[model samples]
Target chain A: MGFLFEQDNFALFRDGFLQTIELSALSALLALLLGTLLAAFRVSPVPVLRAFGTAWVTLFRNTPLTLLFFAVTFGLPPLGVHFSHLVFAVLALGGYTASFVCEVIRSGINTVPLGQAEAARSLGMTFGQTLTLVVLPQAARTVLAPMSSVFIALPRNSAIAGAFSVGELYSAQQTFSERGYSIFAIFFWVACAYLLISATVATFFRFLESRLAVVR
Target chain B: MSILNRPASAGVLYDAPGPKARARYRLFGVLSVLGILGLLWYVFAALDANGQFDPDLWDPFQYNFVQQMILDGLLATLKAFGLAAAFSLTLGALLAAGQLSDHKPVRWACTGIVQFFRAMPLLILIVALYYAFFAKQSMWALVIGLTLYNGAVQAEIIRSGVNAVPRGQGEAAYAIGMRKTQVMASILVPQAVRSMLPSMIGQLVVTLKDTSLGLIITYQELLFVGKKIASQPMNAAGFPYIPVVLVIGPIYIAMCLLLTALARWIEARGRRGANRRTSPAA
Candidate 1:
């Protein structure tokens, strides 16, 4: 415990903590954007796009995040695509997490009653109009809880990025253990840092859910 | 209309296409198909130019030792998954029982344990376990970490499943001469297991995948083996990372998909069985 407060050791843990948050935030944004697109594609009138969306979700959802990280870290460089390690971590985590997010959003969309869409169609709303104006807004409400779970899992999954040299909290653990510090104390703090992040994310989502709650 | 063939959720998003709409969709579809094909071709060309498509890169997989290594890795992964699955389910059941206990302290303690473990990132937990207790035993570290985290998740699943049973079921059992344990064993658990099975299997898939984290601790699971293979530079072009991914990736996908399919099959059968049981009584 005393070693935790040592100047150099504290900096190492702090930097690792910040890097974890940075990776999670960036990847969450990417997952949301890509996932929304996939969800829309899955529900759209275009057969090809729907097929593509389904394939993307299935392929990604079944694959382990670690393997995806390996592919991005090792496989991509050979194909002439290059990026920073952080960027690679983001791509892998975001891409994998997006599959889950897509399912959450699509299921959310499904939970919106069919009558709502039919009414919009009766008003001669186009597909885009019905989806954006009528369907998606309603879906957003039901989607929040599951969507939160998905997002909460994102930071936890980003811990894998540490193994790939993204210098996150897990990497902090690696560093500390190698330096011969007390493993239990170091782990306790690292676990606390993770729990804090998860709790904060959980709280934010609960707030959002409350704000978005419909009285119906 | 063709909308009748699609799921209500998908179909309701748009009306059946009229002639103009149909024409527009056809053109958009064609363009999107062309775009996807173009992207695929670009990727293929890039990989080909980089000599990733060379047959030599795949040579290591053909060797007897390499194949045996993969087989051993697969067995090791399954062995860990088997132990973790058993332990997690047992732990989940105990924790769920404790959470649902009559004593307030017991319930609170169980809830705290579940929440604490659930909130921890599993990799961190595994690594911590590796260093703290199982420094020389990576498999136990992986298994115990998986069990703790997944058991917490499974506890929630089981608790919710039990609660989801209509309150009348338990009341009626108690209204008879049934003891608490008897009521739970005969009435609540059997019913809850039906609903909980799918999610339990789903978690098992997750446990299977998380086994790959063993690679970090130098546990020789399938992914670890694959990584080891990929790191060995057999050809001048590069390490066979792509080849290893192609080989090992499908094994994982196939295993998960098979489990998912099995769950669906069992669920369908359960529904049919329930229908048969009620239909005759009706």
Candidate 2:
């Protein structure tokens, strides 16, 4: 445990922890936003929008995030598309995570009641207005739990960003290994760090759920 | 405008597009196609600018050595997944039994392990297992780490699956002089498998895909092989990054899709059998 407090280990681990947070947070947000768009497309009036959304979901969800990371990190550079490692990693994470989030949100939207949308239309609300004001708000409430799951999964998944040299928490393992520290202690501490993160996020979400649980 | 299709809508959610709306959708559709084509053109230009389209760079994949390496990598990946899957399922079953134990302390310990593992990232777990136990044996580390994390998840699945069995079924098993273990084996486990097979297979897909994470530990998995191929210039081009990824991406996607399809088939079979076993009322 004292090794965790050692100056070199402390700094590297701290940076790694912070990097993990940044990677997950930004990418999760991107996934959520893009997912919402895809979900909307899934149920949109336009057949083409619906098809495109479905296609996007199938394409991304079927593909593994590791492969997507490779595609962005290795594949895109050849195509003259360039970004910082973190940005590219985030894009990959966001794209992959979006497929899942989209499915979750679309299911949430389904639970909003077909009658609700029909009523919104009957009340003279246009498609966009009905979705923005009525459909999505209710869907948002229903999907909070799954959405949180997706968010939690983002951080866990972001560990792979280390492969792309994103300098996140898992990357700290390489540092510890290189530094001649006991692999046990280094791993023990890293596991504890991840456990702390996941546990904290989970508890926070649990607290929110209990505080404002949807009856359904 | 017949009431049959509903006066306003063609679907359950929204009104069918009127002529103007249809025209607009067509416009958007055309724009979408144009946009995709434009993006494709841009990517092509960018790739061509970097000599990524060079025929010479890709021709080497026709050789035996590279092909054998990839197949070997694939087999190694499957080997790891198989070990991890079996161990995790067995571990999951034990932990789930412990979690559902009548003894409070046993239950508590199981709960703690599952929660800790579930929350812990797989990468950290692999790294920890590598350093603490496996030492330089990266394969065991990857396998064990995957097992712990996935086993924790599978515990939840099993616990829920068991609990999902009708209370009457377990009580009846007990009434028939079956012990707890006998009841779990004879009654609950079978039903639970029927219900949980899809999810179990889903987890297997995750497990299969997760084997890719071994590359970080320098395990010679498929992704690692792909990386080696991608990085080697070997010819005039700097690296065949695009070609390697293009080749590898479809292979992974195919495997996942196949796994998912297999799960669906099993689920459908389960459902049909269930429907047959239960009366039509069910």
Candidate 3:
């Protein structure tokens, strides 16, 4: 503990923490959007589209995210399609996560009653209009909690960025340890960073939940 | 309103997709097409630029070094996974039972174990355990770390599965003079097992993937072998990095797919039995 104070690399720690936040934000946003779209495809009227979406989710959901990261980082470069490790990390994380998110969103959509869609159709709305007008709102309520937890998962997984030398919180701590910082102190700080981020997000989700309850 | 019969709202949350949704779909379709085309173009360009598509550079199965390392790594990985899977399921059940215990100490102790272990990243746990305990460490640390973390997750899954089996069923069992332990052993455990099977298998998939983290502590897992292979400079491609990844990717995918299929089979069988018991005879 005293070592942390004496070393006083709080500035470096803060910058590393900020990079983690940036990486999380970008990946999460990209994942949610891609996931929602894939969820739509999974529940599409067309059988082939649904099958394709299911296969995509099944493949990604089954394979490990680390393996996927390795694939993107190592597999692409030899084909003369080199990406910065950071870019590849983000794409891999976002892409793999979106597959799980798609499953969550599809379940959310399923939770919404069929009557809502029928009612929308009775209003002479197109299928897309009916879905927009009726189904997604209710599904959103049901999925909010799980979705928030998935967001929490995103940051925890951001630690994998360290493998590629992305200089996130975990990588920072790894560097500190290599530089003769006490291993315990470095790890303790890393854990604290992860906890802080996760707890903040969990609190925000709880707030969102209560607010949604009030609306209901 | 009932869950199924509620009227839809007009807000974005309530509303489904409309013309804008169709347009968005079309846009994504076009984009996907372009993306695939671009990938194909890149592949061709790489081949043309390199003026050769060399197979030997990347085929680890063809080389004695790569094959030996991967085979050894594969066995080590399986060893860790097998031990962890058994430990996790057993430990998970015990912890799950403790969490649901009437006694406060047991519940608190289990909760603390579960939360702390689950919250810490698996890599850190592996490293910590390797350093802090087990003289040789070997596969034992990796197994213990995986069990500690995944067992916690499995405990939660089992607890929830058991809790979901209605309060009335437990009450009914107790009223029939069945002891608490008996009720849990005979009724709750069986029912929860069925409901929890898929999730447990899903956790196992996670455990299998995590075996790769063994690379950090030099446990010689598949990823470790891949890394070793890539660090060498024996291939004609000059950049055998991509080939190593491509070679290894399928191996991981194959293992995971097998687990997934097994889960689906068990789940199907369980559903059939459940349905047979519940439905009226023909």
* Every candidate's chain B TM-score: 0.94, 0.89, 0.82
Worst 10 residues of 3 chain A by lDDT: A43-52
Better of 1 and 2 by DockQ: 1
User: DockQ (C-alpha) of model 3?
Assistant: 0.28
Q: Considering lDDT, where higher is better, how would the candidates rank from best to worst?
A: 1, 2, 3
Error in Å for residue A181 of model 3: 4.1
TM-score ranking of the models: 1, 2, 3
Q: lDDT tens string, model 2, B149-219?
A: 99999999999999998899999999999999899998999888888889988888889889988887788
> Where does candidate 3 stray beyond 4 Å?
A46-48, A80-83, A214-216, B1-52, B134-138, B273-282
Query: lDDT score, residue A59, model 2?
Result: 81
In terms of DockQ, the best-performing candidate is 1
Tens-digit lDDT string for candidate 2 (A144-175) = 88878777788889998986889988788888
Across A6-28, the per-residue lDDT of candidate 1 in tens digits comes to 85989999999999999999999
Instruction: Assess the local accuracy of residue B52 in candidate 2 as a C-alpha lDDT between 0 and 100.
Output: 79
Residue lDDT tens for model 3, B1-282: 332222233222223446977566567666665765687698778865663356656555586876888888888888889999999999999999999999999999999888777777777667657765753865888899899989999999999999987687899999999998999999888877887899899899889988877766778788878878877765455656666666777787789889988999888888784354463554
| Candidate 3 residue pairs in backbone clash | A128-B17, A131-B16, A131-B17, A132-B15, A132-B16, A132-B17, A133-B14, A133-B15, A133-B16, A137-B13
List, in order, the clash count of every candidate structure.
0, 0, 10
Worst 10 residues of 3 chain B by lDDT: B3-12
Chain A TM-score (model 1): 0.98
| Residue-level lDDT for B281 in candidate 2 | 71
